[model samples]
Target: MRRTATGLLVVMAGLFGLARWMEPAYPAWSFVRAFAEAAMVGGMADWFAVTALFRHPLGIPIPHTAIIPNNKDRIAETLARFLRENFLTPIIVSRRMQRIDVAGAVGRFLADPVPGGRLRKGAGRLLADALEALDPERLGTMVRGGLVAQLRRLEVAPLIGQALAAAMTDGRHRPIIDTMILWADRTLDANQVLIRESVAKRAGSLLRWTGLDERLANAILDALHKLLAEMAADPDHPVRAKSEEGMAELAHRLQHDPELRAKVEHAKEEILDNPAISLWWQGVWEQARAGLLRAARSPDTAVAGFIGDGLRQLGDTLQREPRLAHTINRFARRATVGITTGYGDQIVRVVSETVRRWDTETLTGRLEQTVGRDLQYIRINGTLVGGLVGLLIHTFDTLI
Candidate 1:
């Protein structure tokens, strides 16, 4: 294309030479001479304009020539600024993200099974690689830290109070109370001989001689059994009422009593500090990690199948529940907007710095490769248009 454009310029120059030489003998040659003159001027001017974008024309150091190479850093900054202000802005990104169904897209991606179950296999392998790449000790430490942080943030007293309150409200506490009572009865039955021996020891010598101690022991046992039966059969028994009231008071104190709440908090800290608990938790973590690693590595494992089923179920839920999808999409949009707002400046800086680091030759080559052809056409257009205008001017001059 460049050669073609340059060739046209040569042809116009030839015409101009021919016309200028013939104009002395023929008046009509003057019009051709004028057209060719204008054509050469327009073509040369456009050629300079085009060449200046990539380099200095004819290798001369001219002001404003080699526009792109000389102004590369400025161009980079401008480009980065443009992106930050236009495309990377929070408002623009948020608005654009509003129309995107992020959760729906994720649902479709997860739910749709690929040929030969390759997607699941590929995902498993990817996860396996990621897990293998992690340093086990560091990962364990991070996991432990995260768990501790969450635990520290949790208000244990209020949570326990709420749970206890909920259990009572739903009448679930009755079964627990009944189980405790049954256990107590079994314990009492198991220790009956010990109780009888204690009664015998406490009895006087006269009572022991008449076998009155045995009778007293039996009578005490019978009365205790009857009382237990009464308590078990009567829902409105005083003992049961007292127990319920004590439980209610404890629940209330767990939530509202500062002293009790502090005690609970202290107990929580003690539990966290316990070596037994720590060892148990460490064992659990190791087991869990090992299990996850196995699952990730083996696509056909039960754990892997369970994970796949869970993901499919989640995808189905997302697809079926528009409200959930919308909520997820909203969260995604907000998260994206936050990232854009936070890192946009750094992103722009990185872009500008990358461009600034490029050598002039590379930068010039890239820009020329992108838009050089269109610039050649500009030269061609200028030559033809200039020639036509010159012809019209010549005709007007003759008529006037």
Candidate 2:
């Protein structure tokens, strides 16, 4: 189109110039000469206006010509301002967004199983890549440095103590306590011979001090065994009850007493400071991290299947529940708006900076190559329209 327009303009200019030269020789072609001259003038004026936007006409450096190259910065700034004012303004954006009914469109798209499957697959791949790229060591370090440090600085002992007190009061740990006691009893019985030998060795000095006979030591050992057996047999024994009571009292004090709270905090600090404890924690972290990485990397793993199944179920739920879908869409839209609102200026700056960094000549050349053909139509239209108008004017003048 641009080529055709330019060619027409060039042809008209030549014809007009030729007619001017031939007018004296052929006086009968005066109407044709006048029309050609008017056409040429109009073509040239339009051509100048259009060419001035991009470059100097015929390599002549006219002021305000080559506007794009000379004032590209100002142009870009104006373009950006225009975009912000006309398209990106909050009210305009909101109105456009509301008219689109984006939530409904999205919901309809997701309702289809095929599209939903594709979405899920894409999301899964992204999630897997993201998870795989995450360096557990870095994550652990961050958690340790930021979260753990913050947690350590916080006074969490009182909260923990209160939770413990509640558990104890509700007899949540009774079964554990009973199991431990039973295990202890069985262990003591298993080591009775060793205990008896150690007792005998220690009793020799005691016997000398008290002037007690060997029979007395034997009787005392038998009595201690009997007591252990009785305590083991009766779960509701005074000893067990007293132990439970002591534990409950300790928990209560830890929760309610300031001194106990301080003591708990001190213990927490000690644990956190200990090298052995840190090593233990690190070892546990490494094991858990290795397990997670191994599972995530294996496509055939149950963990992957479980995750996929859960996602499928969630997708199904979203499809079934319009309200949930609406909520999710609304939340996502708001989140998008929030991000754009907060970072839009930065985004614009980045774009502007990148554009500014480009070689102007190269950019202009590329743009011309892409769109120059279309601009030619304007010149062609100018020539045709100008010729018609000139012909009409000449006819009207002849009649007058």
lDDT tens readout by residue for model 1, 1-400: 8998999999999999999899999989999988998898889999999999989999998999999998998999999999999999999999999999999988876676553467667887898788779997788778887887788778799888888999999988888777777887888899999989999999999999999999999999888888778888887889888888988888899999999989988888888777897678778888888887787677665333767688778888889999999999999999999999999999999999999999999999888889889999999999998898888899999999
TM-score against native, each model: 0.65, 0.54
lDDT of 2 by residue, 274-370 (tens): 8887677778778776665554455344223665466556666776787886777667667656766777677666656665666778657766777
Off by over 4 Å in 2: 13-31, 96-134, 140-309, 366-374
Model 1 segments more than 4 A misplaced = 1-4, 7-37, 113-130, 156-277, 280-304
Evaluated against the true structure, the overall lDDT of model 1 is 0.88
Which candidate ranks first by TM-score, i.e. highest?
1
Pick the lDDT winner: 1
The TM-score, computed over Cα atoms with residue i paired to residue i, of candidate 2 is 0.54
